[model samples]
Target: MTPPMTPVCAKPRRRRLAALTALAAVFAVLATACTGGGGTAAQDVQDSYKTLPKESGKPTDGGTATVALTPGLSPNYIYPYPPASANGTVIARGLMWRSLYRPSGEGDQIADTALSLAEAPAYSSDRKTVTIKMKDYSWSNGRPVTADDVVFSLDLLKAALKESPANWSFYTPGQFPDGVTAKATTPDTLTLELDTAYNPSYLLSMLTLLYVMPSEEWNIARTGGPHLDHSDPENAKAIYTYLTKQSESQSTFADNPLWQVVNGPYRLKSFDPTTGSFSLAPNKEYSGPGDSRLDQVDFKSFTSAAAVLNQFKAGKLTVGTLDSSFITQIDALKKQGYHVYGAPAPARFDPLVLNFENTTNNFDKVIARPYVRQALQHLIDQGGYVKSRGVYNGAASPNYSTAGSGSPYPPEFGDQAPYPYDPAAAEKLLTDNGWKVVPDGSTTCERPGTGPGECGAGIPQGQTIDFTLSSANTPAYVGARDIAFASQAKKLGVEVTIETKSLNYLYTNYGNSFAPANKDKWAAQDYGPLYLAAGYPSSNTVFNTGGSFNLGGYRNAEVDKLIEASTFGADPTVLSTEVTSLSKDLPVLFFPTPHTLVVWKDTLSGPPSSFNALLSFLYTPELWYFREQDS
Candidate 1:
C-alpha cells in the first residue's frame, strides 16, 4: 500500500462541511483536522492499525452496549463542574453535557484561538475587552447558548458552592484569567474583560473546560437563597464559593435535570452503580455538527482485575482497563479473537509527592535526597515491568520523564534527556549516603540521628517506610498499588505498605482538603498511572503551588520560579526550557501511563486513530459511526 498522506495543521477553522447523512461522509470534514502528520513515536505505536476482515457497509444507527463500572455514587447537580473524574459522572458528562469550548474549538467547533466563534471576535485594539459570537446551537431542552448561558455558567460555578457545600473546584488562576469578568452584552453576544493582557495561546487552550448551561436551571439550583436574577457581583461571589466548596463525589442532587442539561451529541439514559454499568441514549434534540456513531456508549465498570479479565473472557466486555496482573490475559484475549488496546495515557505522572509542609516525619527522607531520588528512577526496570506484566503485546513502557513524552509536553526532551535503567547508580548512591552493605552484600540505608551515641536512640536500621494510598475501595487498584510497592520498593531496600478507602472518604477526608483527624485518613500517598484524554495546557491545576488541586504537598521555590516564568514569559522555547527543567528535576517519580481502550462489535467506524484515556475522554465520540450489515 502507498504511504499514507501526512497531516498538516490547517487554518484555525477549516471550511465547515455541509450536513450529510452518510456516516463516513459526515466525518470527512472532521478528519480534515487530523492533518496527516504523525504524532510522537508512542502515538504512532498506539495508532497502528490493519485492515478489518470486511465492511458490513451498513449504516448502523441503533444498538445497546453493556458496560462494567462502579455504580451508586450520589450526583452533583453541577453536572460538568462536578467530578467527571469518576466514571459515574464521567458517563453523564460525555453523554448529556457539552462544553462552551472544546479542546479543538470554542466548544464543538475547530480549535483556533484567533478565529474562535463562527464570526471572528471583535476585540478592542487593546485586546482587553473581547466579544464572542454564539453558534446556532441549543441545549437538549431546546434552549439556545446565549451570552447569558456563558455568563450564568461562569457566575453559577462560583455560586453553586454557596447553595451546596459540595461543589467542583475547576476554576482558578490559569483556567480563568486573573481579574477577568464575563457578562452578556446581548442575547447572542458574550463579552469578557481582563485586568491584564492574558496570553492568547495559553488562555485559548485553558478555556476548553467552559461549559454553558441554561440560566434558569443553573440559577434555580445554585441560588437556593435568592430568586432568578442577572449575573452580577452581588450573586457571583456567593455562587462561586458554594460551587468551589461543594463535595461533588457525595452531592445529594447530582443527577437531577433541574441542573443537568444536554447540549451535546448524546443524553444520559440510566446507570446502575451496583452492577457497575452506565447506559447512554442518543439525544434527538442534538443539533451539533459532525457524525455520531452508535446509538450510545456504555461503560461497564469492574473493581477487580480478575473480574474485568473474566468479563473480557466472557466476551461481553468491549472496552477495559486492568492492572498489569492481567498481563497473562493478553494472549487469551487475542486467541479468543479480540483486539487488544495499548498506549501511554496523558496528564499522568505517578508522582512520588513529598510533603514539604510535613516538618517532622518523612518516609522518603533518604530518597528525597536530590541525587538519591534521581538515582532511584534510573534503577526502575521499565522493560522488565512490561515483560512481567504481559500488557498488550508486551506494549507497556515506564514513565522516566515528567513532561509527558508524546503528551502536551515536549517530545524532543524525552530523547534528549534519556535516563536508561541503571541499577548500579542506585547502589552507588546508597553506598555514598551512609548505607552499609550486609555481610552477604545486601545494601540498606540508615537514618541520620537515632543511634545511642547519636541522640541516644537506636538508628533507623533500614529505611523502613510506611506509605498509605487512600483511593476508593477497589480490588484492582489495590492490586496494582501492591504490585508496584513489592517490586520497586524491594529494589530500593524499602518496605512499602498499601492502604485503601472509599472515594467519598478518601476524596473528602484524606485528600488535600482540610487535614483529617485519624491516621486512617492518610499517612502517606502512593497513586499512579494518570489517564488524561484532554490535551495538556500549561495551566494544570494539580501543578500550581498553593492551588486547590495541590494535594500531594509538592513545593519548590526554584520550581515555582521556573513555572512562573513560563506562565508570564512569551515564546514556546522559554516555556519548553522551564517545563523541561521541571521534568528533569525530581518533582515527581513518574511511572508508566497506559491508554484508555474503546471497542465496538466490529460494526462501528471511528477516526483512523484511537485516543488514549485522558482527562478529557469525550473527544472522539463524534468521530465514531455505526454501519449495520443490512445497509
Candidate 2:
C-alpha cells in the first residue's frame, strides 16, 4: 500500500538528536551480514555513489534510454494533489511536471523550475507572511510561468480539499484559508500570508507538494469551457472531477490534450497499456538543467523481478533497481558490464499495526491493553523474519520507533526496543495478565480487571486471542514474513488467519480512514513499509490522533500532546523524549528497516552519486543521461 513506503501524510516539524554510539556498532554487524554473497564490493558501492565510467570524447547529442518500472505499476492519477497518487504516477508526472524547488543530489533544495525562488523565505516582522519570487520560465505552450499560476494552483488545492477533505493532508479545513491567502504582488512574485507563524522548515518542505499546473488547462467547467471560476462550488467540483477522470483514463497518452502541456524535460510519446511500457521524448522547450541528452527514454515494466533481471542480463535495460532476490548475482552482473550501487536505505519501516477501533468482534477491547500489544511484539521473530525475507540480506534490524533506525533522527531514540524476540517472555507477560494460554489452540482472558493477573476493562472472560493478519501479495517477501510471524505467534497460543490482498486494496480500503467499512474488517495489517519525506521525520499524519494515515485509529492523549508539541514547539529534547516514550509504549510492532538495492548498465550516466532511493531517484529523472560512446 502507498506504493511500497511512500508516505501518505503531510509535513510536520522534525526531531533532532546527536549521533549514537551503540547504533553504529549494530549497523556495522547488520551491514556485513546482509552483504554476504556479494562481499564488500556491493557494500562499498552502496556506502557511496559510484561514478559512471567516463567517455574519452565530447558527449553525443541524442540517444534513447531504457528504464524499468515495477510491474502492475501504472499512474491512475497523474495529478499530484490527489490522495490516491502512486509511485508510477509520480514518475510519469516528474517527466512533465515542474515544482518551485527540486531536491539536489544530496537531497537539498535547489531552484530548478523557479530561478532563485528563496533560500530561507523572507518573513514579515510578525513572521506570519512569506514572500517568494519566481524565475523566468515558460510552459511548453509558451505561456510564462507566473505568480498567478502559483496562486491558481493553491486555489485549486483549496477547492479540492473542500470536495475531498481527506485528499489534502497538509492543511486543516477552515484553518487553511482562514488567514492564509496567496497574493500576486507582481507577475514574478507571490506572497503567502498566514494568520499564525509555523515551523519554517516544515512550511518550506511542504512547498515540494505543490506542482504548478497551467490554470488555463485545468480550471475549466465541463460545459462552460475554459473558466477559472473555482469560487463557485459547482464549478470547482466539476473541474476537479473532470481533471481526475481524464488522468485515470489513459487509453492514448499522446491524444489527450490535458497531458500534452508540460514544463519539465520530457513529454510522453507513446504508452502501451498491455505491457505497462511508455516512452518519453525530450522537451525542446524545457528550461531546467541537464537538457535532454537522450532523444527518447522508454520505461519498461515487468511482472516479476526475474523478468527485470532477465532484461538486464540481455542488456535491454539501461537502468533498474535490483530486487533483493538478485543481490547475490551482483558479481555476475558486474562481469556483464553492470554497475551496482547500494541504494540508500529507504525512509520506511515495516510494522504490524493493530486496529484500535474494531468494535465488530469486541477485539478492540483486548487490543487496547498495553500488555497485549507488547506481548504481540515479543512473539514476533523480527531477526528471523529479516534473515528469511532474503531482501536486504541481514541488513534489516528490529526497529521499534516510528522514526526509522536509518532516519536522520539520532539512533539512541530508537536504540532500545521495549519488546525483543522472546516467546517465553511473551507467554509470561500474557499469563501474568490473565490470558489463559493454550499452546496450540487459543489464549483467552481469564480475569478481567484493574488488578494484577487481570485483563483490561471491557475484555470479557474467555475472549480468545484470535484475529486475521492481512498483508500485501506482491514482493513475495512480505507474504513469507507474515506466514512466519503467524507460525511463531501460534507457539504463544495466538490464533492468526493470514489474508493476502493487493497493495491498492490494503491501503485504500483497510489502511485509510476514508474506507471505514474495510478498516473495521481487519484486526492487524502488515503491508506498508511506511516512509517519511527526506529530512522530515514527523509522524503527525501517521500516529497522531485522527491523522489521515492513522490506519489503526490509535488514540493516546500523551502521544497526541507530544505530537502537537513537536510540530509547534520544535524542541529537540521534547521530540527525543517522545520517541523514547513510543519505544516503550509499543503502539505498533515494528519490523526491520531494509536497504534498497539499485543496479544499472555501465553506459548510463548523470544519476546522483548518492540519493535516498525512495524519495530522490524518481523525483529527479532529468539528471540522468547516456554516457558518450568511445568510437
Candidate 3:
C-alpha cells in the first residue's frame, strides 16, 4: 500500500535549515509583565485561551494583513507539488494554492477547492475501482481545470519519486500507487482503477496532497520542446527534472508562466528575495468556499521570535505565533491592545531516541534491553523539565504512544504513560537486570545472556552505562533540557555525556542512512518536543523496521505489525489496542508536549475555532478578514 499523504513535522535532515533562537529579552519582559497585582496571573491563564477576537459582526472587505515569517528561512520552492517544510508549504501552497480537502478546526477533513470540482468517491463492489466525478472549474489563466491536470500531477509525482525518494514521505521505493491507474472517463470526470481493495479513507486523504497543476503551462512543450507523453518513463523523468529545476530557481518564481496559473483564492503578487518577504493578491476568478476579504496579504520575515514579537508589540504584525518563553507576556500583549490566546499544545514532541544499531560503540547491546529502555523513561523528570522550560499548563505531559494526544485516536492510549518519573524504579530496573550500579558513578553490566535478570545478548560484562546524548542546537530550550536529563541520569550511575549539534547535522549525519559514517557516532539523540503530522496516526514512516525516519534503527516485530494494521484503516478498537501495546514497549523515551502560543491583533478576525492550526496555520487564509473600524 502507498504511504499516507499527511502533514508530518518529523525532524528534517536538511543542511541549511536555521535554528530557532531564544527570546530571552521577551522572557525578561514577560516575567515582569505577568507579575504584580490587578491583572490576570500568568499561572492562572490557560494556554488554551482563545486569543483572536470574536467575530462580533460581519467581516469587512479591504485592508491588508502583515504576517511574520522566520527570517533567512524564506521558501525557495513555490510549486505546490514539490517537497517543502510545513511553514514554507503553508505560505507557498496553503495560501496561494488549493487542495482537494482541508482540515477543519474540529480535526475533520472538509472539501476546500474540491467542494465543487469532485464528488464523494464511489467504490466498486470489490472496492478495487473508485470513481470520482469532476466539475468544471477555471484556472487563473481562464483555462478550465480538466481531468488531464490531475493525471499530469500524479505522473509528475511518480517521476519525481524516481529522482528523489525524499520528495514524499508515503512513497515507498520501487512502488507506484500500487495497481492504480488514472483515466479520464469524460471531460468532467476522472476514474481511478485500483488492482486491489484499499482503505478508502486513506485513499481520499492522499488526494489532498496531490495538487492539480496546469498541464498546458507545465508541459514540456511550453519550454520550447516537443510535447512529451507522461506514459513514457523517459519523458516523465525529463519533465519532472525540468520542473524541479525551475522550482529550485527562486528568481524565476514571479516570472515563470507555469506558476502564474492558479485555481486557488490567492495569487503571488510580488516577492522580495533579499528580505524574504512576499505579497499575495486575491485571485478574482477564484470560486472556492470563502471570498478573500483582504485587498492583499503581506508576509514579513524576522530574524528571531523576539523580532516577530517586537513586530506584534509595535502593531506591525496582524498574526504571528508567540514563543512560549514569552508566555508571561500575555497580559502585557493584551494591555497593548493585542488579542492574546493560547494555542493548542504543539503536535510535536522531543524524545530521547536510543540507537539500536550495534555499530555505535556496541551501545546497541545495552540499549536493546527492554528494561534498560524502560529505566531511561522512568528517569525523565517531565514536570521539572516543563516548568524549567516554561511550557504552559496542560501543555507538557508524559507521552508514550506514537499517536499524539491530538490525534483522532482514543485518549486512553495517549494518556497512558507506562513509565513515570521514579529514580528508585530506574535504579532497581538497572540493578535487577544485572547492572552493577554505583550511585553518581557509571553502571557496568555484570550479567550477559538471554535469561531473566540477565543483560540481553551481545552485551559484555563490565560494559559501563556510558554514552553521549546529542540534541539539536536550536530552540535553546532543548539544550537546557538535555543537560538536565543528563544530570538526572548521572544520579542513577548512568554517565550521559551531552553534545549539541546543528539540526541539519542531527538529521543528516545522525538520522539519515545516507550518512552511515556518523550513524554510530552518537548513542542517543534528542529530537523532540513534538513531531506533527496530518491524518490518522501510523508509525509506518518513523517506527516500522527500516522506515525512512527510523533514525536509531529501533525495531520491534510487534510494532511493525501494529503499524501495518493501522495503515489499512482497521477497526478503531484494534488500532487502539496496538497503540496501547506500543505505549508500554518504550519504542522511544517520550517527553512532554510543549504549548505553542499564537497571538493576533484585535483588528483581525475569522481564525478557525477548532483546527490543528499549529500544524497548518495557513490552511485557509481566505476565511480571515479585517473588521470595519467604528467612527
Candidate 4:
C-alpha cells in the first residue's frame, strides 16, 4: 500500500499565523499596509535590488549562530530522500549532502555553476548522451568524491523506486532515472545515455534534486560488512534497505558513522529528539567553496509563530524568519538592532486546487465549462487580501500565473490579470452562458444545451452552483481568503461552504487519487503554496494529463502537448507559452504570492548571496560569521 502524502511547505512566511494577541498593533500594521501599490493594490512582485549592508568591524571566528527553522518544520530524518511524513528535510538535505547541481537563487537561471558539485554538462551531437565532470570535493572520511559515487547514488535511487514510488515525491513512472543509464567514464567523469533527448534546462532542473552519497563507505548492506558492487541491482537494493532502516532510528542520527560522511560544509554534531532541534559542526574535509568560520550552527524549531516572535524580541536568535503576522513589529525589530528584508519566493505560487473529478451536485460538468472557471477566478480578491488587516497585511504580492510573480518566464498577459476581480463581469459571464443571475440567492442553470449561450452538456437545467472548499487551518491567510471568496461567491448567488482542516490531514486524505471514496466529499482545497524546481518551473507532473501529482484529475490535450514541448524541446520560451495557456484556462485558481520575510541580527553577517538562498528554501550557514569579537 502507498503511504500517506506530505506536501513540501517551502515558504515559511505562510507557515503559521499568530493569534491576534495585540489588537492595537494589528491595526497599526493594517494602517500602513497600503504604503504603495496604488489603484489595484497589486504591488510588483520583483525582488529588491538593494543589497544588505555589510557588517562593520573585522570578522571573528569560532562563534555559534542560532538559526530558526520554520515553525513546526523540525528535521527528523538524516537521509537525503525522506518519507512523506518527514518534517523538515529541505533544511537538512542542502546542509548535510550536496546535490549534483546547486539550485540558483535567482528566478532566471536554472543552476548555480559556481557552487555545483559538477561543471556544466557537455551534450553529444545527438543530444542523447551527456558527460559531467566532477569538481574537487571530498567526503568527510578524506576520500575524494568520484564519478562512481554519482552512478552509485543513481542505482540506489532506482532501487528505491522499485520498492515504492512514495519514497521520492518527485518520481513519476517512466520519467527521469527510468530510461536513463549512467556509467563512470573515469574517476572524475560520469556519463549518462538517455533513451530520449530532453531540454537541457529541464534536465539541469532535475539534477538539482540528485544528492550524491559516499559510495566507498556506503556500499555495504550492513555495518562492518565487506563492500559490495553497488551497480548490481540486488546489492543496491540491500544497501538502500540498510540505509533506510537506519534513517528510521532517529535516536542514532548523530552517533551513526554512516550519517557523518558529509560532502557539504556541515556534519551532524547533535540532535534533540523531543524538540526536533539539531546542531551542525563544520566538516574539516569539506572541499566546497566558502569559508566555515563558525564553530557551530544550531537550528531551533517552534510550535507557534508567537513563540518565534518572542525569541526575536528577546534578541535570542542570530538569524531567523519573521512571520507576516508580526509585520507591525518591523520598526521595533529595527530598533532592536535587526535587519529585515523580504520578497516573493522564486518559482513559488499559492493556488486554490480545484477538483474536477468531484462529481457531487454535477460539479464535474458545471466546472468543465470555461466561463465558470473564469468566473470563479474573478471572485478571488488578491489585492484586497494583501491590504486587509486580517490577511497578508501588504507583506505579499499579487500573482496571476503559474510561472509566479516577477518570473523571468512571465506569460504574454504579464502582470495584468487575465481575469481581474470584477463582480459584474463574473455575473455577466454566467448570465450570458445561460444561468439565471440571482444576487445573494440560489443561482441555477436555465438553459441546458451544448450550443453557444447555454450550460454545457451533462449539466441539468435546475443544477445549483454550490461546492465546499476545504481550507488549511494553520496559515491564517488561507482561512481568511477562503472566507472572503465564499462571501464574494455568495454575492453572485453561489454557495461556497468553508471547511477547515490541518495541512497534514489534507495532504493525507483529501487527494482524489489516494482517497477515491472521498472524491465527492470536497470540491476545492487551499493548501497555501507549492514550490517547483528553483529556476526552471515546469508544470509537467502538475497540470499534464495523468500526472502523478495531478490530484484533481485535470485533463487538457493542449496543455499536455505544451508541457511535453517544454520538457523535451530545446527552446526555453515554450515554458512561457505553456504558462500562458494555463493562465487563460485556469487549471487552478491563483492567489497572491507571500513574501519570505527574513530577519537577522546586525552583528551576524555573510555574503549577500547567502540571504538570497532563504527565498529558494536553501541555507548556507557555513559562510556566516560574527562581525565583532563580542557578537
Q: Which candidate is the best by lDDT?
A: 4
Model 1 has an lDDT value of: 0.47
Q: Which prediction has more favorable TM-score, 1 or 4?
A: 4
lDDT tens digits, residue span 122-144, model 3: 88877677787766667888888
How do the residues 270-292 of candidate 4 rate in per-residue lDDT, one tens digit apiece?
99877778999999999888789
TM-scores, one per candidate: 0.73, 0.85, 0.86, 0.90
- Against the hidden true structure, what lDDT does model 4 obtain? 0.79
Q: For each candidate in the order shown, give its overall lDDT on alpha carbons.
A: 0.47, 0.63, 0.63, 0.79
lDDT at 612, model 1: 32
lDDT of 1 by residue, 207-259 (tens): 54566666755554253555456466465654544443442423333354543
Q: Which is superior by lDDT, 1 or 4?
A: 4
Q: How many residue pairs clash in each candidate?
A: 48, 2, 14, 0
Top-scoring candidate (TM-score)? 4
Model 4 lDDT at residue 556:
95
lDDT by residue for model 2 (397-514), tens? 5677766655555335446666887888889889999988889888888887868789878888888888887766545456555665676678788888776665545655675455
Better of 2 and 3 by TM-score: 3
Alpha-carbon runs more than 4 Å astray in model 4: 1-51, 54-57, 83-91, 513-518, 629-631
User: Where does candidate 3 have its weakest 10-residue lDDT segment?
Assistant: 1-10
As a TM-score, model 1 comes out at 0.73
What RMSD does model 3 have? 5.1
- Which portions of model 3 miss their true places by more than 4 Å? 1-44, 47-53, 70-73, 81-91, 108-117, 174-176, 343-350, 389-398, 411-414, 504-510, 513-517, 528-535, 569-573, 610-615
lDDT of 4 at 553: 75
